[model samples]
Target chain A: MSTPVQAPEAGQATAPRRLGRGTLRFLLPPKVIAGFAVVGPMEGKGPMAGYMDTTLEDTYYGERCWERTESKMLKEAVQQAIARAGLSEQDVDVALTTDLLNQCVGSSFAMRSVQVPHVGIFCACAGFASGLALAASLVDGGFARAAVVGASSHHDAAERQYRFPTELGIQRPPTAQWTVTGAGAVVVTGGDAAGPMQITHATLGQVRDMGLKDPYDMGSAMVPAAAETLVRHLQETGRRVEDYDWVLTGDLGRVGSRILIDWLKERHGIDIDGRHSDCGAMMYDASEQDVHAGGSGLGASACVVSGYLFKAMGRGLVNRVLLIGTGSLHSPTTHFQGESIPVVAHAVCLERPGTR
Target chain B: MSTPVQAPEAGQATAPRRLGRGTLRFLLPPKVIAGFAVVGPMEGKGPMAGYMDTTLEDTYYGERCWERTESKMLKEAVQQAIARAGLSEQDVDVALTTDLLNQCVGSSFAMRSVQVPHVGIFCACAGFASGLALAASLVDGGFARAAVVGASSHHDAAERQYRFPTELGIQRPPTAQWTVTGAGAVVVTGGDAAGPMQITHATLGQVRDMGLKDPYDMGSAMVPAAAETLVRHLQETGRRVEDYDWVLTGDLGRVGSRILIDWLKERHGIDIDGRHSDCGAMMYDASEQDVHAGGSGLGASACVVSGYLFKAMGRGLVNRVLLIGTGSLHSPTTHFQGESIPVVAHAVCLERPGTR
Candidate 1:
């Protein structure tokens, strides 16, 4: 299903060039050799079902509990990604992973048996995007020959931790997005590899708080950060909306997606109306899925990119792609303390090997 | 008290060469220009009190809650570290931060006002070591000329989340370590910078589970991981224990340190008795402080390195040091689920630029 990228000889060195204002231009771009996604039954019935590598018969995935299930799904995604890339555990040097679970136990436990050097990262749902930037940096800098990045989230596991328990069957407001029960992994290698997808540029994001405190309304809280990063990436990279075939966001959902378009147009004088599509908004059939706002969780972006987007890219459906992963950086503790939510977004530019 | 490191011209590119196994040898190493530690009043009376930049009279640090106080301390540490380096926040390209808090609110909320690009990392207490490696990779690879890495933890905040509430005055087992109420930050720059401390190499650690499930006995659970990383680092770098002035382990505390010494001797046929110390074990005067096993939090390593160790390094007390940050990756939920503790350790080799 995927062609493996060639790795540089052991002890090789690569360089990364810092570009205008917070942007990094990898001199030897990192190649995305393979991606795999494992999702729950509901997600398998969604729009991108065909692209899913594995759809569990039950949420437990045969595990004893939801947390264990989430961990198992992440591990499966990673192993499948490596296998799909024609690589093995030994070929992978590092694994950068995270999930919405407290202390990032989902990724930690998942990577426990993978035997790859692991680094846990957390930026709420934006973890996958941050993981990509770091993994690409490692590969591009020759710190690692191949790096695997993954993120996972189980709806039940996340609900009990962030909100009320699923057993309570508490009502969710219209502003609340449904946490996706899925996991995704991607294999990134050095520029020497022969892969269709290449990460050429990245932009690091700053935390931006707009004084929004409603935990249910995370989309609104995260919109400013998304806009900030997208604008920064475009300006720093000297690119325009027309320069890319698509501008994909992580999981801003319906309300946040609308806010993003209007915010970009009003604040940055840039319009992405036609170019923009959100992973969250596209995850499910809005009318049929019964997801209030849209699909969320780190898994939302993870599953969408690893399953739908990468497959589309392989088929030449989209070439130059700018993916911005946005996150709401607030804990229930902070929300209870009446503090405003802080948010962040990271942008990575992936392109077809020979494309503009 | 410190000198600012010189940064290369914008767009400069540097290379990082891969070493044996899991180590990365930086062609141009990153220099630690400055470090700052902030602690609560209880920590102020500890052995390293003199080294602390600020010791708050109260745990809240004038904040309304323990969580906010932790965030404030992290931000203050970052600001003070940059200032001590004779740089401003604008000069820092990135901030890699994490804490014991769920979702890493301590670092994220702290970075909210700093305006620097933020990357949240979590490896329990090993986050600072991971952050240092990533920060060094960015600087060495020229992705960022200047990056600041910080970790923070508040004892009260952590107790309520990881265990029982402080108000309960729960009796801790003798093997359990006291969480540190502190924060630390360090500014890292490209090798062009003339600084006293240089990070020459780094070794990423893999997760290791030894099937030890007792949350109170984290030291025993983490020992195997510490030994694993330490051995890998030595074998990869071709360095013996005698090569380093000190082999520091992050927050192994008393029990874990003892276990590490024995584990290394038995498993790896290496001994680190005379050259070893633990940040957790050394954080307080055990007899006087009544801190059970010892100080154990992300802040334990952060405070020690930024305060005691760095000061000692500056004074030529230690030249070449290999600091291994250790973490036991287990949450209350994992414990409740009957899972063994998974642990990880990351090592960074720091040296006085001219030293052997």
Candidate 2:
């Protein structure tokens, strides 16, 4: 193997001269004219009763877990979002999508059926926020007139790839949340109309290695990184906890959510009491939802924000929201390294101009 | 499990209202400010002998493959493009990236190491043009001021996933091209600058099944899709075959290239003989570069265009260029369905205003 080479220092010789900026710059920004969400059919439904179940038998790719079941959920979510935004497929200039599949199977395949110009994205669970940031930037930059950001996840599919099969009787940790098999999408356009909220500012956190292991415990793995990024975003954008009516994270589950709240108070001296919640926790309503934790990348938070919260926003139940997504930076190596998992986070603040 | 509920129609009743026009909008159009390319250490000197060596180690992760190895090369190419663009990481509003990894491991992980706001994307091999289209739209929609589009592919990594391990002596078909383990990135920004050309328009093709079985034979799997999208783009934009100085596809190896050309002529009657080329064919000298069929995804076309062609444009070697990325819509199920592989294509046109 070639000797490990060092990445060039900022402004150093041998470094690409223009790579000095530590952050992305925006020439234009997207106005969130409207957004929509679709909750997956799996929510409220019991564990996908295995391939033997009648529903599973029908949807399964001939009884294979790798089949494209998630595509259906994704398409539904996107269609709902587009409709909510009062836009047609023809009006969408770009489709920015991401998912948990290895090569973005959900988004790519979903777009195949939708027939929209698409650019699939992947950032683990953090993809939703990252995609939103990009779409907003694209709209702000004048590169597109309108765009869509979407993501999805399926428990049966994720379990097969990341853990033991359901029939194997593997013990899932209390912190491990069932991967929600659902999809959520939002439409960002340049011109304004009545919508839930306008995306004010988006801040991205750098990937940091806090040295956590165990990809299964994504909440614990991601909390520190999520905390760091959320704090940094508030600082960089010159916003404070009080500014947002609600501060939300994608899928921190019950365990991660508590840890995050504590971290915010102790580390950042921020208090997020009633104003803070989690998509993971809200998706199934702790009691009704069997997912021990709350939500994860696929469609957990996406459905809540787009379906429940967005609907609420449209009805004038809520006015402003700050959505942050957390992702674990663990790869097969990180798992093999016995090293602590690194994590990343991104935040997008949304507000309605004339809402309460 | 819930039974498969019928999906709502596009304009079905009870659907959410769409956002009307005249809403607040942001538009930032991207201009090709500059571009560059750089061959990384893995290019000629590495554990793998030259770029054709079947074995390579992943930079971020261990265990070598053509995919990860090529990703490192694409990273260097992107660095060069950023340098040529005369922009820093901070200048980039969003770093839009994609690759062929099941989880987009190369692009997402590599992006964490970079300082830009990373948004990893995927569309299989079609990622290059898809990214360009999205980036350009971001610029045109006023979402970002400047952005970068990147893609990469590796032989070692891809081979292990698609076919027998290098350790296993396996016969391969000539139609199968070794995935080029390389990376390429391009910087797109708003406003004018000295560069090859401005991106005029981008169009995407629908995914269609042509009943291709072997995942290795991507050329045949993708040719039809490429033809359909390219023709549609031309017709929609009201441009004829000779409008572009050059029209290129991502990686249609010799066999697929011929097929695509023939199909285009037969189907669209728009002759693009000398004007058309493939990134897969151009990346290496046929004899010297053991890439039998051509490159796929990853940095295949992006690297070539940004590194080689962008540089040529800077030196006044060329003026206008049209890049098209083709992707194979082959899922594990396409094989099961006894279906032919469907293909999809996306295209972006770039040109120097004054010179052209």
Candidate 3:
């Protein structure tokens, strides 16, 4: 059953003053009550298939269009997350969600059925972290008792908008990554009721342009952003690479993840080789799947972090974790105009109570 | 000049835990230090032209591409705003900005030049208030000392993506609202450094659909959302319609504002006649500009509020104000699919010092 949330007393305020300049030190961190993932057939068949709550036998998901299917998946994810938390839509105070579609169509349309307060945000692939951060802020600031954060990305829909249509079946580049087809949803509340899934701190990142115009090589373009956020988060929070049980990136793919590792070591002397892993690389079996670099999309990081990691943490297998969400901000028009790509990353500290 | 920000002591913690359910009570409401607006020649010739800091001789703004021009205007608006605040980009903790372009290209790219932390949000025409609301939260929650909110829209760019190309010169319907060509920027900071421009409360809105499918007639589609938020805000804040010196709505255009006013009186027994005005209606003279119903876009509301209203508050010409930002949550594809348009409205309560 759902219950009202209250802020922790002054004496219970455990966090240090807001870290650095752009970090939120949640004195009473919000809890992740439940999470759910819905993936397409290909993604369901991948290495991370077991983590998903539902996987469509076909990409259409019985919808007429791929965009419609995306909306369905997002709505289902929200419903499943609420059901898992034993709460109904009526109990939710608000929903913070977004996707890659123009005007955030997927989030707005999908969430319309719920009828709760909502705000469709846009942070590109970093949407998952952005939604989570805002949801946590809403809960921590006592604006909502329960805030739902959701996002989705469909291969069919994304391909035509960002690249070529699926009907073309154009030859793919080795550097290009597959857009994961799925949706992820999480229910965030104020307190430690959801024990192993507490959100303690957040570091919002700035935009970084790297002069890479090729959309296919987005992985390469997103490296600086991931590294920048990681360094700032570590420095501001007084945290070391080893402090986290796992440091996960949104969708850096194989190439970008390696670049991040190398850059961190060279620039900050911070080596996270053993402790760091990327959602993109973890989404599929790189060699077996045709996805050249790895899997990437808003869904990749969201599904992995919420579906896979939440269960892992619940089993006491993993404890403290840092999720660094990376997004390459660009439009087809901007790219066509020969402009550089702008990227960003936001990091959130999640942990089990025992680990803290 | 630029100083590191610190959280205030206990006595200075003047706000409640948070405002009403849907509102964020900024214990330490962030102050609007400065704002700037830049517009195209068409908008410069309108009624609100004097509110703009600069009016371009042409929509091209000396850029090769019209979209590039939009980016330039946004960048200049931000730079002017920061300078007016007596600071530079380095002094900014973060920038929360967005625009009408796909993937928020304009804001992200223009903001990359600033090199501060950036969060590209997308809420359609609600972007200005969305940006300001989030910026205020970042400051109030101790995440940033100085935050910048920016947004832009170019008529040529919006026409091409949302409708036919500018070259097409298609005849628009009477209900169609013209997208404004301009950008607006506001600098926000924690504490009350800018005494006359404090943001006190915010009410995030929910998605509302009235089964309207025409994209061109967005004003009619957005009326329900505007009314919903206005009523909720008034109910929660326990304020009468006359409490505010002004109640401004973002780009509902001529037709939508009339519908909103009628609905308010009929549904809530609230008559906001003389105290209220729509940014869309004020941006242009419907009879003279041939903008159909009126003006629409993030730039419309953003410019009026940040540029004109900020100055008014500073000079004691206005005291209490409520800005309700409305957004249409639909895309071209959604319309093609015959889906009903979804709309949203967010309200931010702003005031001059000594009113609290």
Which candidate tops TM-score? 1
Query: Highest lDDT, which number?
Result: 1
Query: In candidate 3, which residue pairs get closer than 3 Å at backbone N, Cα or C atoms, i.e. clash?
Result: A206-B117, A206-B118
Go through the candidates in order and give the clash count of each: 1, 96, 2
Estimate every model's Cα lDDT from 0 to 1: 0.87, 0.63, 0.84
What part of the reference interface contacts, as a 0 to 1 fraction, does candidate 2 reproduce? Answer: 0.32
Error of 1 at B2 (Å): 23
**CA deviation > 4 Å runs, candidate 3:** A1-17, B1-15
Off by over 4 Å in 2: A1-42, A45-66, A80-88, A137-146, A287-290, A329-334, A337-342, B1-91, B137-145, B196-198, B288-290, B329-342
The interface root-mean-square deviations, each candidate in sequence, come to: 1.4, 7.8, 1.8
Error of 1 at A158 (Å): 1.1
* Cα lDDT of model 2 by residue, B1-356, tens digit: 11112232234223211111111111222467655443333333321223221222434334344444444555565666677677776677667777665566666556655666665666678887777776676555444567887777665666665555777867777888767666767788763443445665666555565656677687877887778767766666556767677788887878889888888888778788888888777766666665567555555676667666765655665666768888765545345545345566777776554432
Listed in order, each prediction's TM-score against the native is: 0.96, 0.81, 0.95
Interface RMSD of 2: 7.8
Candidate 2: give the TM-score of chain A.
Answer: 0.83
Model 1 whole-model lDDT (C-alpha atoms): 0.87
Clashes of 2: 96
Q: Supply the TM-score of chain A against the true chain A for every candidate structure.
A: 0.95, 0.83, 0.95
